[model samples]
Target: MDLESHRFISYFLPDQRPELCHSATIEKFPPGTVIFEENEKPDALYLVLDGKIEFSKRGGLGQYQNVAWAEENDFFGEFGVLDGQPRSARAVTCTSATIAKIPRDRLMDILERSPGKVVLQLFHHIIHYLRLTTEQYVNQMVHKHKMMAVGEMANTIIHDLKSPFTGISLANSMLKDLHQDEETQEWCNLIQAQITQMVVMTEEILEFTRGKATLNQKTFNLGESLEKFQRLNFIYWNQHNINFILRCDNIILNGDENKLMRVWQNLVGNAVEALDEQGGQIVLIAAKLGQDALIKISDSGPGIPEAIQSRLFDPFVTYGKRGGTGLGTAIALSIVEAHGGDITFESQAGKGTTFYIRLPLC
Candidate 1:
C-alpha cells in the first residue's frame, strides 16, 4: 500500500518515505475480533488496508451502539494517539481485515528527523482535526438551543390554556347539578373528559421539558403491576382492537412502578401508531435473567424506519406522525435510565420491532 495516496497517512509525509514506512507494521484481524475497546490507551494509529471495521460505543445494558464504520483506506485512533488520551470508542473487525499499525512514538520520531515536508504535513493534519472538532461542537450547541426554544414556547402555551380549562371544568360541574336531562348530561361528561385529557397532556409536556425523572422505588410484583396497567389502558387498547398477550414470571422487582409503566406506555403507544387502525398483537414478556430482570415488548406492526434508526432515542427525533412532540421515547429513556436500567431494541424495516428493557433484580 502506498502511504501517500491516503489522506490520513499522507498528511504525515509527502510521499512514501521508505524510512517512515519501515517503522510501521501490518497486522490482520479476523471477523468479530475486537481491535481496541473504549477507555483503552491508544498505542498506535491504524490504517485500514482491506475489509471493514466497526466503531461503536457502549449503550444501555451490555449492548453496544454503532457509531461509524471504517472501510479500506480509512484511518482511526489518531485523535487518541495525538492527545495521549484513552480511546473514545471501541473498534472491532466487521470482516477479515488488514491494517497498518503505525506506532505513534516511531512516527513522531521519523517526522521530527525530516525537517521540511514531514513537519509541514503534520501541522496541516493537526489544524484539520481541530477545525472538524470545532464544527461538531458548534452543531451540537445549535441543536441544544433549538430544543430549549421549542420547550419554552410550549410551556407558555400550556400555562395559558390552564386558566380557561379550569373555568370550563367549573362550569361543567355547576351545570351538572342544574340539569338532569340525559343528552345534556352526556355533553357535560364529554367536556369534562376532554378537559381531563388536556390536563394530562399539559403535565406530560412539563415533565419532558424539565428533563429530569426521580424514581419512586419500591418492591412490587411485576405481574400485579401489569394487571393494574392493563386496567388503566384497557379502554384505548380495546377501542383500537389491539391484543396484548402478557406472559410474566411474577418476579418481584424493586423499582418505580409508575415510571416503568410510563416506559411501557410509550413503547406500546409507538407500536400502536405503527399498526394504525388495522390493529396488531403486542406481546409483553417478563422474565428473570440471573440478577437482572428482562422485559421485552414485541409488536407485529411495520417496524421503525431506517432514516432515524441510529438516532431513535434522541430527543425531538420523530417519524411521520400527526401532532407528535417527539419527546415520548426521550422521556421514556430518561425514566428507565434513572432507575438504573438500560433500553435497547431490534427492528426490521417491513417486519416488526422488539424493545428490551433490562433492570437490576433486587
Candidate 2:
C-alpha cells in the first residue's frame, strides 16, 4: 500500500484521494524541531508518516506546557485546516520524524468536495482521545484521594493514643510515690519499663508508616521557593497548556516548604486542568503585608462554576472538570490553617479566578 493509504487522508473517498495524496510532500525533521507556533497562521496540515509530534504552548516567562501528542499515522493542525484559523497549539518533533505535509488549499478543496466522511473522521478522533484522557484522569484522582484517606486515618489513630498514654504515665508515677517496700518498688519499676517500651514501640510504628509525619518548618525565600517549584514541574506541565508566571518580593517565610508547595501545586494544577482545550495563564504572586506574607494565585480560565463555590473547601466538593472526590482543595485549606494562614478566593464566571493566602512572615 502507498504511504497516504496509512494516514488520515485515507478516510476520503477513493476517487478524491488521489488529488489530496499528490499534494502532500513527505519531509524529514530531526528531534526537537519546532513545526509551528501557537497562533501562527497555518501553512499545512501534517501527517506523521513515522515518529511523534508534541503539541504544547510556550507562555509568559518562557514557560512551556505540553497539550497533547500525535504519533505515527496521526494527523495534526486539523483545527486550522477546518476553520482556516491560526494554530491553537505549538507543534514540535519529539523524535526524528518522517512527515507528510499536505498544503492547506488542496486539503480544503477535497473537504469542499467530500466533507461528510472526512469531517466526522476528524472530530471522532478528537473526542475519542479526550474521553480516554479524562477517564484516566478521574480514575487516578479517585485512587489518590482514597490513599489520602488512609493516611489521615492513620494520623488520627496516632493522635488519639497520646492523651491516654500520658494519663497512664502520670498514674504510674503516683503508684511509685505511694510504695515504700522494695517488692512494691520493684513492681512499680516493671510497670514503668513496660510503659516506656510501649511509647518507644508506638513511635517506631508511626515512623515506619511516615505519612506527613510532622510539619518541618524552616525559613525560606518565597521567590526562590516558587522558582524551584516551576523547575520541578517541567514534566507535569508537559501534559497541559498553562503557563505559570511568578512575581515575588523575596519575602522570608517560616513554614513547612513541602506542605506549602503542595498548596500552590493543588491550586495551579486545578487551573491547568480547568483550562484544558481552552488554554490559559496562571499568575503566582507573593509579598509581605504587615507581619503576614500574602500569596495570590490567579488563573485566566473560566471562573469557578457557581454551584460549588460555597462548598469549594468542603471535603468532597469538585466542579467544572472531571468528576473525583474533591479532597485536594480541602487538604490545601487544612494545611494553610495548620500554619495559621487564611485561604480565600474571588471568581467571576468567564473572567477567571484568584485565590488569596496569608501566613505569618515571622
Q: TM-scores of the models, in the given order?
A: 0.59, 0.43
- Taking all chains together, the TM-score of candidate 2 against the true structure is 0.43
Best by TM-score: 1
Tens digits of per-residue lDDT, candidate 2, 62-170, equal: 9776667888887888778878889988899999998888898888777888867777886788788778656655665575566566556646766887788788878
Judge candidate 2 against the unseen true structure and give its global Cα lDDT, from 0 to 1. 0.77
lDDT of 1 by residue, 1-362 (tens): 55545555565544546655677788889999999999999899888888899887787797886656778887788778878899988999999998888898976666556668666766676677567656665666676676787678768878899899989999998998899899878778767865764565555556666766655689999888887667666678988889988888969988877667777878888888888888889999999998888999999988888889899888888763555767778878887788788999999977789999998887
Report lDDT (CA) for all predictions: 0.79, 0.77
Every candidate's CA RMSD: 10.1, 21.8
**Best prediction by lDDT:** 1
Worst 10 residues of 1 by lDDT: 11-20
RMSD of 2: 21.8
